[model samples]
Target chain A: MTLIMVVDDDLDLAEMLGIVLTGAGYEVDLVNRGDEVMPLFSTQNPDLILLDVMLPGLSGVEVCKLIREKSMVPIVMLSAKDDKQDVVAGLEAGADDYMVKPFDPAELVARMKVRLRRSGGEVNSDLTIGNIVIDQIEHSIIRDGRIIALTRLEFDLLVALAKEPGRVFSREELLSQVWGYRPATDTRLVNVHIQRLRSKVEIDPENPAIILTVRGVGYKAGVPGSFQ
Target chain B: MNSPFKAWRTSLVIRVTGTIVLLSIILIYLAGSALYTQISSGIFDEKLNLSISDAQSTARNAQFQLTFSQYQDKAALKSIFAEILAVPPKTFDNTAREVAIFSFAKTKVRFKFSGASNFLEVTSIPKDFRKKTKISNTTQWGRAKLSYINGRNEPAIVVGHTLKIAGAGNYEFYVLFSLEQQTRTMALILNYLWLTGIALTFLIGIITFFVLRRLISPIRDAARVAEELTAGNLELRMDINGEDEIARLGYSFNEMAVALQQQISRLENLSKLQQRFVADVSHELRTPLTTIRMASQVIYSARDIFEPKVARSAELLVSQIERFESLLRDLLEVSRFDAQAAVLEIGEVDLTALVKETIDYVHPSQDRIILLLAPITPVIVDIDPRRIKRILRNLISNAMDHRDGKNIEVQIKESENEVSIGVRDYGLGFTYTDKKLLFERFWRADTSRARSTGGTGLGLSIALEDAKLHQGEIDVWGERGRGAHFVLTIPKFAGGSIRSRPISAQPE
Candidate 1:
């Protein structure tokens, strides 16, 4: 059984979310205040977090950052604002995904499933991209005797590019392959995630080598021995 | 193409100054000619009087000398006549005065002996004047030509008189006075007059130009300031110097600017207030609406446990709440558009994929009401996905609503800078005239027809605004009983303008 912690200031919404998660065959832990999330999160050690943006003591974004500092657990934010700033802010704070309010409950479950999906690579799996070694089992990247930390999404993005070094992938293809999103949608998800991934993996985020952009088309993996 | 005349026509200063200069030129010329003629004629009359009296006195003296000579012998008479014709020594002074005489023989009148002092040519007298003077005993004067033996001629006045001598034959005596001195004096006077006229015209022109410019400068400034104000610079004002008519105009213009600024600021404040109210209302309403919607959904999950009536009521409640939520969303969008502050978050995406997504979202079931003609290659572009999605959702939902259980077509096409998505439906089409009013907010069709399609009435209007924000447009074609078609064309990039629509609203 998987444990999911739900954080919200609104009691009824929090309870409703608890009921929905319980019906989906998951153990639910509900916290009303944002301040109460951290203490309970460490003790309960839930598999996932469903946090709301607006909270009484701490914001959902701040809570996401606090959680990201310690753990790589999947964090899905629930914000009433569909505004770009709010969504992007949550994503930048290391929240894996977000859903706007008044969203269908089933869609929320589907998004959570995408976030909680396990990477299918075996422990002995080794991938190489642009002179950087990616150890799938250890979930770490090594470049010239230096180890780097990458979130699950970023790691998956790198692997997706490294797995098929020759094939060029558009944002739509990456969205479907990495984020499990259908092709019939906006590709900003791929854009923001790719940026986050590059900032972690690339030595210089300004000029990326692992993922090279092809003008008027899409992006492709750089040739082997390309990273400097 | 630009002639001086044409330039003058267009320029206010040149037109006025040119007209004044032309009038002054004509006036000065006429006045100058009249003054010149008056002075010249007066000087000529004085010289003519002096010449006439002097000629008469010389002729009388000659007659007296001749009578005394007649008493002597023929040789003495000839000697006296010769002495009378002998010219005095030539002087350097240019008196130009000379005397001439012609002696008539008693029986030989055909051969006239004409002699002149200083060898002045006697034939210089006009033939007409000589004939008249010979026939008539009166002393006559006429303008004459003075011919010297050196072949030079000068204009002169010749006064001719005939004397009936007692012994000598008939003698015609005349005096020729050169009018050169009088001509010089007249020329000097005319030169002064012309100089004075030119100087006066220049002074008048300068005075008129400055005075007119002074009067029109304020007006010109006011016109310029007013033009700037009309061009949307509301802070500009006319410079008021004194309490004159022009200053009064400046004051009034300033007052108008003040009023205009006040009106614009007031309207802006009012619009800001309205936006605030809408934002606040949306925030306040959504909290409760979310709770209600979720509560309804939660209750709806266990509908099988409840009675059929209650279960059906719960379903209706849930659907209506969803419709109400969409209404709230549309109202908020319309308010944002009205405030002119709706911003576009542009990203590169495929229109074909977007259309497919909208179809799936609107009609998730493979129902008979909808059909799609999608593209193979992705029509990639930079656009605000959320807004375009909203517009497509509105358009497709509209198609489904009025679909009249008939099949629909969603087509996508692209051009270089513009991409067009057209939704066609073979259903209860509107009248040709109503097509124009279709984009108007809250406009409904046929009160008699069934209101089966639930709409907030702001969807089309909002969609139109979304297209306009992208510098795009929507064209519609419809007719009664025929299918309705709507085409939306937008540029490929943010801040780009639509050049050519890939698909037109007209049926092909």
Candidate 2:
């Protein structure tokens, strides 16, 4: 059984989330303060984290950074304010996804399922994009005999692009494919995550080679052997 | 810089200075001419008096000499007459004196002789003056021009007397005094008068310009400070100098600025507090509302195992909770607008697709109640998709509420700089008078009718505000039991103004 960690300052909301997650057949651990997340995180090592933006001891953005420093566990932030600054800050701090307050319980469960599932299970062969090689089975990418680490979300995004090298994926399409979101929603998630992925994988993040951007359309995988 | 004509119209300083200079020029010209005439006439009168007296003494001397010689022989009389005619012409040290003797025109005398002194033309004395001298006896005098044989003329005063020569008949003795000296003096005085007049006029102009500028500077400073204050620099104040009228103006202006700044900051603080209170209330309600929502959903999902009435209660609870959540959301949005904290997340989007998406979201049923009319090509515009979609959803939902089972039409049109979406329905529309109240928060068309759709009553108000945030306008047309049309027009580009409407509110 997959275990999930829930961090929020509101006791009733945390307990309610516990009830919803447990009802969905996932074991749940509820933490009240943002500062208490790491101590429990190291002990339990949950499959995913449901973090709230406002907490007693620390902010959700700081907690997310702490988690990223040590682990690659998927984090989905819960924000009460739908302000761009809060949302973008959480994403920049390495949160995989976020849902505004009062979101549907069914939708939260669906998104958690997508995050927890192992992606690219059917693709047995290695995929080549630019000078990088994507090892689907090992869930990693190698460039010039060096392994590059990526988060699960980033890995899923890359595999989705590398699977069909010739096709261009719009932000909405990628959101639906990788993040399991419906179309015509916030595209900022794709933009922020793409930057993060490039910072980790590309030689120079200023000019990307592996994930080529198509203006007014979306992004696509670069041609093989295109960049020295 | 403004044109001179525009400045004359707008600037008090320019207008006042120009008028003052023009009036001064006219006054100086009039006064200068009057002074010139008085001084010139005074000098001429003095010169004429002196010339007449001098000529009178000389005439008396010549008459006595001629009388004294009359008792002698005719030769002695001739010598006396010759000596009278030999009076010296004008010299540098003496007044210009010329003597001319003429016999009376009707006199019958033995030695009738007409002679003039020293190359002086005998016709130098005007015939009219000679005729007056012949008739008058007491030192007859008039003005004349003394002409020399060399073609030179001089303005002179001619004094005449009748001399009784014993041998010769009555002779007209005239002495001419040249007025050239007096004429030169008048010319010099006129030149001085002209220079003084021009200099005085110029000085008046310069003085008026400087004085007006000095007086208007304080007012100009006040205007500049007022502009700065209006531009939100509330700290600006006028500079005051000595205790004068202008200084009083500065003091009052500063006082007004201080008062205005206080009032504005007070209002700002009051609104800020109000916004903070509203924000806190809404945000504080969200936590428990979320918990209640999830709890209600849990109970709703398990309603099948409960009794019928209890299950129905659970469904109602969930639905009402959803409604409450939506109301809170709308209240927050309205408060944001009131605080002027709303912002746009601008992007380029195909407006036709956006409208279609909203229509489908609002009415997902396949009953074919909503029909969309748009061009084949995509109408791409820079806008906030979320807000535009909200506006469209509100308009379409409103149409559906009063549609009366009739088909609704949603038309999308675009101009070069503007895009508009119009929702038209053939249903129980509102009265024309109710158009103003349509956008009022929580206003209902019919208070007696049941709100079956469970709307929050803030939809249309929020929609109008959202359109306004995009620099757009919402126009409506309606009639009793006829139909309704709501059109929203906005600029196609961000920060652009609407130049033309793609769709009008009045249906054709």
Candidate 3:
């Protein structure tokens, strides 16, 4: 059984979240304070973390950074304010996804499921995009005969671009395909994640070549075997 | 010329100095001319009196000499006349003295002897002056130009007297005194007056300019400080000096600035506090709302195990909670607007695609109700897409509610600087009076009708705020039973203002 850790300062909300996720056939570990997340997280070894932005003792953004320093676990932040600074701050701190308060619980569960799903399947095929090889069987990328670690979402995004080498994916399309979001939702999610992904994979993130951007349109994969 | 005119209009110091200089010029010219006229006329009178007296004494000497002479021949009288005509001529340094003897016209003896000394032209005396001299008994004098036979001219005073001779009868004796000395003196005086007048007028101009500039400098400083303050530099102030009228102005101006700065800072603090309160309220309320939403969903999922009425109650609870959550969101947005704390997240977006998406989101059914009239090409604009989407959603949903099964129209238009989105509905129309209060928070056209529509009562108000955040505007037009139209106009670029609206709210 897959285990998910829910961290929030509000006890009732955390309890309700625990109830909802347990009903969805996932074992749940609930923590109420941001500072207490790491101890429980290390022992429980949950597959995903549901963190709240505003918490006692430590902020969700700080906790997210702390978690990112140690592990690559998927983190989806729950923010009370839909303000851009708050959401971007969480994302910049290495959160995989975020949901504003008063979000639909069914939608929350659906996003959680997407975040926890593994990209590699029985049909494992090696893919190449801009001189970087995506090894589906190993769930890692090989660049210049060296392995590069990537998050599950980043791996899925790379695979989506490599699978269809010629097609351009709009931000909205990428949101729906990779983040499991509804059509025409916030596109900042795609923009921030793309920046984060480039910082890790590209030689110079300022001028990107692996994920080439089509101006005023969308993003597309660079030509295969074009390393330099 | 244009630059001086512009300076005259713009600079107070230049204007005042120019006016003073002009007035001084006129006054100095009048006074200088008056002084020059008085001095010149006095010199001429003094010279005329001396010439008359000197000519009178010379005429008496000649009369005595002719009377006492023992000569009986015309040759001896000719020698006497020759001696008297040998007076010296005038040079640039010396006043000229010339003598001429003329025979009277009615004399019995006809000795036609007329001669002048120092090569003086006998015709130098005007005929009018000669006639006056002949008519008078005593020595008569008038002003004349003494012309020399050598072609030299000098201003002179001529005096004439009648003389009796033994053989030569009724000879007219004349003495011409040159006025070159007097003219030179007058010219010297005139030069002095000119130099003095010009020096005085220039001094007055310089003094007036400096004085006025010194007096107005404080005021100029005050204007500069005021401009700085208006440009949001709150710390600027005028420099105050001693207690005078201008210094008093400085004091008062500085006092006003202090008060203004204090007031502005106080308001800023109050707005900050209000923003903090709004944020706190949002955070506090959202936590509870999240809890309630999850609990309601849990109960809603288990509604099938309960009684039918409880199940229905659970359904209503879930839906109303959703409504409450939306109301909370709108209230927070309104509060943000009230505190002037709303920020724009600008991005390039396809306006046509956004509108189509909003229409689909609002009305998912295939009723063919919304008719979109737009350019076939995509219309891209820089805007805060979330706010724009909210505004469009409010307008479209409001239309859906009041459309009354009539066809709705959504039109997009673009100009050089602005873009307009117009949503029109032909349904149960509102009165003209309702348009005035349509955007007011919690204001409804018909309370009973609006209550049934399940609107949050803050939709239009928040929509107006959202439009304002983008520096845009919303216009509404409605008439009784004739449907309503709403139009939103915004700039195509961030930080730009709408110059012309592409779509008007008025129906054709």
lDDT agreement of model 1 with the native: 0.81
The better-scoring model by DockQ among 1 and 2 is: 2
Tens-digit lDDT track of model 1 for A101-178: 777777788777776777875557788888789888878889888988777778888888888998889877887787
Better of 1 and 2 by lDDT: 2
* Residue-pair clashes, model 3: 0
For residue A161, what is the lDDT in candidate 3?
Answer: 87
Model 2, span B1-508: residue lDDT tens? 5599999998888798889888988998899899989998898889889878988888899988877664566566677778888877678866678898887879887666788887889988988888888888789888888888999988888889998776667988998888888888889988998898889878888888899899999999999999999999999999999999999999999999999999999988987887777757765888788899899999999999999999999999999998988999999999889987789999888898889889889999888899999999999889999999999999999899899989999998988899999999999899867888999998888775527766788999999999999999999999988899999999999999887889999877
Question: What fraction of the genuine interface contacts, i.e. the true contacts, does candidate 1 reproduce?
Answer: 0.19
Residue B52, candidate 1: alpha-carbon lDDT: 86
lDDT of 2 by residue, A85-156 (tens): 999999999999999888888989999999999984777999988899999899889999999888899989
Q: What proportion of the true contacts does each candidate reproduce?
A: 0.19, 0.70, 0.84
Off by over 4 Å in 3: A120-131, A161-169, A212-228, B1-3, B62-82, B95-109, B112-124, B147-154, B160-174, B181-192, B241-251, B302-307, B365-368, B375-378
Docking class of 3: high
Give candidate 1's error at residue B89 in angstroms: 13
Error of 2 at A180 (Å): 2.6
Model 1 CAPRI quality: acceptable
TM-score of each: 0.76, 0.87, 0.90
